[model samples]
Target: MLPLIPYALALPLLWATGPTAPDSLIIFNASRTYHYQAIFISPAGDTLSRERITMQPSGQPWVGQPKRQTACTIQYRYNPGDSLTFAARPNPQNQPGRQPQAYEWRKSTVTGVIENPQEIWMHPIRSNQYAYTEVAPFPQVRPADLHPGGSWQANRLFIMGGWGAFKGSVRPFYQVKAPATRRYGNQNLAGCWLIESVGQHSRLGNSYLDFYFHPRYGFTEMHYRFYDGTQISLVLEGLPTGNK
Candidate 1:
């Protein structure tokens, strides 16, 4: 017991010395139960903080049967006139394996510029369906289009394509269902775009993209549903940025 005392005393100090982000914020939110291992990150791409929160589930009214937890992170440069963007391509881990004879899926890019704390230009490169030619066929606009006047008015959610031989043949697809404007009110910018029409073969294939914006941390809630009944839901509540 005597040697254990020293180890216990050092435990608190070890956690205190853990790495943290430079100047970012993190929020942890739960829907069912508290999770001690929850982690939050910042837009500067750093771990801001971690916390545990108690949660209550809506459907099942058991003592502790269905417990759930979520985390959120924000990263942004604060230096005056500073700018940055986040980008990621679907890797083998998130996409189906390509056959030698099959046409490979090109990497899609989405760019967002930090403009104050109120607005951002989240632009994406548009392309043709069959030929893969860029939509804007001119030298100035063919490669990319930077829509600067836009703002990050809603949550951002992405669905990952799973790896399997049958995955490619299952008809990759995705959809976005907007809520009734009169009931929910049109508040989010991303939600305003209804996905009524989508190509047969799409990255969002058979996936549901859903998210809601929070005040402090921008967008927090995210839900992605796959065709085979698998779903991933995440929520970041109590973000320092207050909601509308």
Candidate 2:
């Protein structure tokens, strides 16, 4: 048998030889600007309208509160060092009267994290509608490490200004279907991870989300269905374009 070594002496050797942590599940390039197309669908399966969305690194931090009565009591801050801003604008090609009233906002910006890369602000129902704000205390949208068949679940809080606050829960299941190929008009894309999340809200009932995420491109496609029969879909127009 080999001679035993002191714990302290062996610790460094063990760490050096141990497996290194895997790469992050998703990667964001602060220098690049991402573009996406948002499609609004009515409960009756009709297409309501479409909007163009652009996501980029924010130069300035974001500070605001949910439009709640307690807005004065609570404030949320998103620093530029670790967050991205998503801006939505009306599509010039859209037909007249095609845009819904809730989607009329010309400039809608939402903030998401760069580390975990999950939307921390805005309701999932409509793009930048600001109907409600979500705060996930656990914030487990995806696993920290990338792998096939990874899954996670967590609780989320929903705060609606003037409508009161409610508690909610979210369970996300992820699966790596196959190797990446030409998708969303982009010939170069990393592997695709499909995630399905089932959410239960204390007051709003149930909601469902099915989205495809790319490590290098972020979310390539997303489909959301709310309790009130509202449905929205977002698809990346193509690979992001910008310096670096």
Q: Highest TM-score, which number?
A: 2
Tens digit of per-residue lDDT, candidate 1, span 1-244: 2122210110111111222221322221112221212233332445433333222212221121112111222222122211111113112232344542222333232111121222211111111111111110101110021222221212122112322221222221223334221112223323222222111223324433344432233333433333333333334433232111
RMSD of each: 20.9, 14.9
Candidate 2 lDDT by residue in tens digits, 93-202: 23344442222343544443323333211123222332321311221234353455555544333333322232333332333343445477645565766666666665
Cα lDDT for residue 40, candidate 1: 30
Which residue window of length 10 is worst by lDDT in model 1?
134-143
Compared to the true structure, candidate 2 yields what TM-score? Answer: 0.57
Backbone clashes under 3 angstroms, per model: 18, 1
- What clash count does candidate 1 reach? 18
Candidate 2 Cα deviation (angstroms), residue 181: 3.6
Q: Which residue runs of candidate 2 sit more than 4 Å off their true CA positions?
A: 1-26, 59-104, 116-141, 163-182, 186-190, 242-244
